[model samples]
Target: MGLPKPLRLKHWQDFQATYQQGKRYRGMYLLLRVLPDPRLNQSRFGIAVSQKVSKKAVVRNRIKRQLRAILLSQRPNLAGGFNVIVVVLPSAVLCKYEHFLRELEQLFKQAGIMNHGH
Candidate 1:
């Protein structure tokens, strides 16, 4: 399973917009780009795991799956109305869930998207 429809950023245009307009934050294995989309009541996310990260589809897909799970777990604590794109680095191929989780949490905090009141 993947991220829910509402939470997934599926369009290329949206991806481009986020990439062009969003603020970027870097982690050890992930790069996050965030843009405010006040028209929506919920946040949306896109994940990018390119060939540069892993030439094998299995490895790339595994990374995406782990990322989706992490994002879903963190969603409740995140602020609404932002479009966030997560780009996986090549180093992430060797990363475990705990590493991704910690880095994502830190990046979210660095980006000021985690809602403490939650």
Candidate 2:
């Protein structure tokens, strides 16, 4: 399973917009591009695992799955209306679920996106 429909950033254009217009936060294993849209009532996310991370489709898919799981668990505490793109780095290929969760939390806090609000 993946992120709920409403919470997933499905369009290529939306992904482009977020990449071009969002503020970037870098972590050791991930990169976050976030754009806050006050008009929205909920946040949406896109996870990117490039070929550089792994040549095998299965590896990339597993990385994406782990990230989606982390995001789902953290969703309720996240602020609303942000378009967030999580780009997986090559360094993440060896990371575990708990490491991914910790990195995401640190990145979110660094980006000032941990508060609850409308």
RMSD of each: 0.9, 2.0
Stretches off by above 4 angstroms in model 2 are 116-118
Give per-residue lDDT, candidate 1, residue 58: 96
Tens-digit lDDT string for candidate 1 (8-82): 999999999999999999999999999999998899999999999989999999999999999999989999999
Give the number of the best model, judged by lDDT: 1
Supply candidate 1's per-residue lDDT for 5.
Answer: 100
Q: What is residue 29's positional error in candidate 2, in angstroms?
A: 0.3
Global CA lDDT of candidate 2, please? 0.91
* Candidate 1: stretches off by over 4 Å: none
Write one digit per residue (lDDT tens) for candidate 2, span 1-118.
Answer: 8899989998998899999999999999999999987877888999999999999999999999999999999988788898999999999999999999999998888777787451
Error of 1 at 12 (Å): 1.0
